[model samples]
Target: MPARERNHPLRLLTGALASSRPWTFLRSSQIGHRIRHSLSAKLAVAITLAALVLLLVFGIIVASQLRSSMFETRKDAILADASLRFSSAQSVFSSSTATSPDQVQESARGALASLKASAAGAGATNVALLRSEGSTASLRINQIEDEQMRGLITPQMREAVAQGGAQWQSVGIRASDSDKVSPGILVGTQVQLPRAGTHELYILYSLAADQRQVDVVLRVLVLSALPIIVTLPIGVFALLHRLLLPVRLTVSAATKAAEGDLDVRVEVHGADEMAALGRAFNAMTSSLQDTISRYDELAKLQQRFVSDVSHELRTPLTTIRMAEDIVWDNREDLPAHARRSAELLHDQTERMEQMLADLLEISRYDAASALLDAEERDLRPIVTRVVEACAELAQRQGVPVEVVAPARAAAEIDERRIERVIRNLVVNAIEHADGTRVTITVATSATDVACRVRDRGVGMTQEVADHVFDRFYRADTARARTTGGTGLGLAIATEDVAIHGGRLQAYGEPGKGASFLMTLPKHAGDEIASWPLALWEDE
Candidate 1:
C-alpha cells in the first residue's frame, strides 16, 4: 500500500481516540445528581446500620443483666423459705418433751409430709427427708427410701446435724426411676429425746419454681424486643424518604436549567445545602441566558455589516467597468499619453473587478453558500498547467520555472477552486521570485495528494508570514506596487483550500526563499491522511 493509505487508518484511529476521551470534569447537573441520589441513600444506610448495632449491644446487656438478677432473687427467696421451715420444725419438735420415740418419729414424718405438700403447691418438685446416719430406716419413712435420699443429702447435712439443731444445706437430688434431677435446699436439725439418743431431721425444698420464673422472664424479653427490632428499619426508611424528596426536586430543576430552560428555578423551602444548591443553579442559568442573548445580537450586527458592504460596492464597480470599456474602445484614436492613460485605467479597473470577485467569494464562504463540485482527478496535471500559464511572466523576469511531477498524484476535489489555488500560488511565486528559480512539485499517496510551490524570491520574515493570508496584506508596500497584483490572491486561495477541507501553509525566512504547500484529501469529505510536504528540510 502507498504511504498515504497506510497513514489513513492511523489518522482515523487517532481522531477516534481523541473524540472518545472522557471529559476532565463532570458537568454541574451531573455532579448534583450524583450527590442527590447517592449521598442521601448512603447516609441513611449508614445511620440505620449504626442504630442496629447500638440497639443490639444494649439489648444484649439488658437481657443478660435482667436474667442474672431475676435468677439471684429467686435463689434468695427459695433459701429463705427453706430456712423458715427448718427453724419451725426444730422449735416444734424440741418443745415436745412428753412424746414417745415412735410418736415423735410419726410426728416428725407428718411435719415433713406437710412441708412437701406446701412446696409442691409452690411449683417445687422432689421434696424429701434424710436421717443424719445416712439411713431412712431409722425414721421409718414410707414415701421414699434411703437409696432415694442418698443423692439429696451431702456432707454438709452431717455437719449441720453435728453442730446443733436448726441448720440448713442445699443439694441436687436424683429420684428412683427418674433420669432427671432437681436442685433443692436441704434443711437438717438435731432432735434430742429420752429413749432415742439423737435423731437428725431433714427437709428438702426444690428450686423448680425459681427455674419456672426465669423461663417467664426470658419469654417476656423476647416478646418485648421483637417490636423494637421490627420498627427500627421502618423508622429509618421513613426519615430518609422525607429528607431525600427535596434533593430529588433540586436535581429535577437543575436538569431543566441545563436543557436551556433558563427560567426554571427550584423552590427552596429550608435552610439546607440542597436549598443553597438550588439558588446557585438558578443564578448561573440566568447569567448564561443573558450572555447568549447579547452574543446573538452582536452576531446579527456583524452579518448586517457584511450585507451592507456587498450591496454598496456592486453598483459603483459596475459603473466604473462600463466607463473603462468606453475608454478602451476609443484608445487607438487618442494621443500617446492618452492611450497609455486609458490602458492603465483599464488594467486598474480589471484589478478592481478581480478584488470585488474575491470579496464576494469570501462572503459566500463565510455564509456557507460555497458548494463543492468534487471529483477524482490527478493533481499533478493541474499544477503543471498552472505553472505553464505563468511561464511567460517567469521568462520576462529571467526567473527559472521548474516542474516536478510524481508518477501518480490523484485526489477528489472541486476542480475549479483547486485550479484557482494552483494559479494563485504560481502567480504569487512569479511576482516575488526577484529573477530567481521557481519550483512546483506534486506528489501523491493512497489517501491524499500534495503540491508545493517554492520560489527563491524576496522572501518574507516571520512577521509577514503570520499575516500572509490576510486580505490586502503585502510583505513590502513598494514590492506590492511593482507587481500590480491584487492582494486578495493568497487570501482567496486560502479560503478555497479550506472549503475543500485541505490545508494551505506558507514557510519562509528573511532573505531565504519561500515554500507554499497544499495538502488535500484523496476522497471528498474525507480527512487529510499524509502531509507529503515537510515544513523544513536539510536542503
Candidate 2:
C-alpha cells in the first residue's frame, strides 16, 4: 500500500500533537486542563495571592515602625541616665586640689565609683572614661575588659561630643573577644574635669529585653493573619457550587429531550424563574406528543384505504380485461381506422392493469404483510427462463441481452420473487438502453450472491439516483408519459427484493451509463456478508 493511504490516520494524529497553542497544552494535560478551565481553581489562586500580598505589606510596615519606636525609647532613657550621672560627678572633679597626673587618675577613679553607685538599676551595663594628655590618650577608667570592646569608639561620636552635645551608637554586647554576643547601645559624652582636663564618658545600654518584646508582637501578627487567608476561597467555592445545582439539572433534562426522549422533564422547586421554565418545557412536550399521535392515526388510515380500494378494483378490472381481449382478438376483421383504435384501447387497458397490480404490491409492503417462500435451486435455469421471456421485448427495442455466469450456480432463494425482481430490472434496463446493448451478470460467493444489470444509454444524475426508490417518482418528470411504465416497476421490485432479505441499489452518471445491483444471502438462514462482484464494471 502507498504511504499516504496506509498512514492517513497516523498523520492526522501527529498533526494534532504538534500544535503550539495554549489550549493544546491545557486540554491535553489532565491536571493542567482542570486547573486552567476550572472556576474554583482560578478563584482560589486569585484570593490567595491578593491576601498574601496585603498581609506581607502590613507585616513589614508594622515590624519597621515597632522596631524604630523601641530603639528610640531605649536611646532616650540611656542618654538621660548618662547625662545625670556625668553632671553629678563633674562637681567632684572640679573641686580636686591635686595637679599631678597620678592624683588626676586617682580622682577620676573615685568619681567613676561614685557615679556607678548612684546609677544602680538604671539599665546601664558598664562605663568607660578616656583622657587626652598632649598627643597621647590614657584610659583613666575602664569597667568592661575586652580589648576589642574598648576600641568601639568612633570618630564621629567623638566629634559630636567635642561640639558640646551627647552622641549614641547601637552596639553588640561582647564581654571578651570570643564570648557570646547580645544586643545593646552605646551613649558617649565629653566632660571637663579640673585636674584631668577634657575626658570622654561612655555608657552601654543592654537591648535584650526590648528584642524579646518585639518577638512576641510578631508571633501575634502571624496567628491573626493565616486563618482568613486560607479558608476564604474554599467557602466561596462551596456556596457557588450549591447555587448552580439547579442549572446543571435543567441542562441534563434538556439534553435527554433533544436525544428523542420527549417524556423527560425537570423537577420544579419553589416559585422561582427556573421552576417556570420547567413548567413551560413540560407543556410543550405534551402538546407535541398529541400532535404526533394524530399524524400516526391518519397515516395508518390512508394505507388501509389504499389496500381496500386495490382489492375492490381487482375483480372488476379482471372482467374488463377479459371483455377487451375478446374485442382485441376480432380487431383484424374490422376497418383500418377501427382496428387502430382497438390497438390503442387494448394498450391503455393493459397499462391500467399493470398499475393496479403495482398498487396492490405496494399496499402489501406498506402493511408489511409480504413473506418469502425459500427453497434450494439452481439459478442457471431461472436465468434462462427470464431471458427467454424478455426475448420479445429485447427484440422489439433492438437491444441485445448478454449474460455472464458459470455453468452451474446454486443457492437457496424464493424462486418466484427473485425471478420477478430480476425481470423488472431487465425490462427497465431495456427501456433505457436506446438501442445500446444491455448486460446481465451473475456471480456467487461463499455465503452470498449478486446480480448486476448494466445499460449503455440514458444514465441518471445525482439528484435522480438519490430519490429513485421513492414510490411514484420519475427521474424525467418533463418527459411525455407515452410508454406503459406505471412508474412503479422499480418500486415494487425493490420491495420484493427486501422481502427476501436482499438489497437493490442503483448507480449512474449523467451522460455515461447506469448500473443496478442486487445482492442476496445464498442460504435462507445465512447472512449476506459481502458481495461477490465489484460495484462498478470498471473494477
Top-lDDT structure, candidate number: 2
Model 1 residue 202 lDDT? 58
Which digits, one per residue and each the tens of the lDDT, describe model 1 over residues 316-368?
98998898899999999999999999999998888777766776777777677
All predictions: root-mean-square deviation over Cα?
A: 19.4, 15.4
Q: lDDT score, residue 82, model 2?
A: 74
How many backbone clashes are present in model 2? 0
Backbone Cα, N, C clashes tallied per candidate: 0, 0
Clashing pairs in 1: none
TM-score of 1: 0.48
lDDT of 2 at 30: 73
lDDT of 2 by residue, 171-235 (tens): 66665656745567667666776644677777666766676677667666766775776676677
The whole-model lDDT of each prediction reads 0.68, 0.72
Q: In model 2, which residue pairs have backbone atoms overlapping below 3 Å?
A: none
- Model 1's C-alpha root-mean-square deviation from the true structure amounts to 19.4
Model 1 whole-model lDDT (C-alpha atoms): 0.68
Assess the local accuracy of residue 190 in candidate 1 as a C-alpha lDDT between 0 and 100.
62
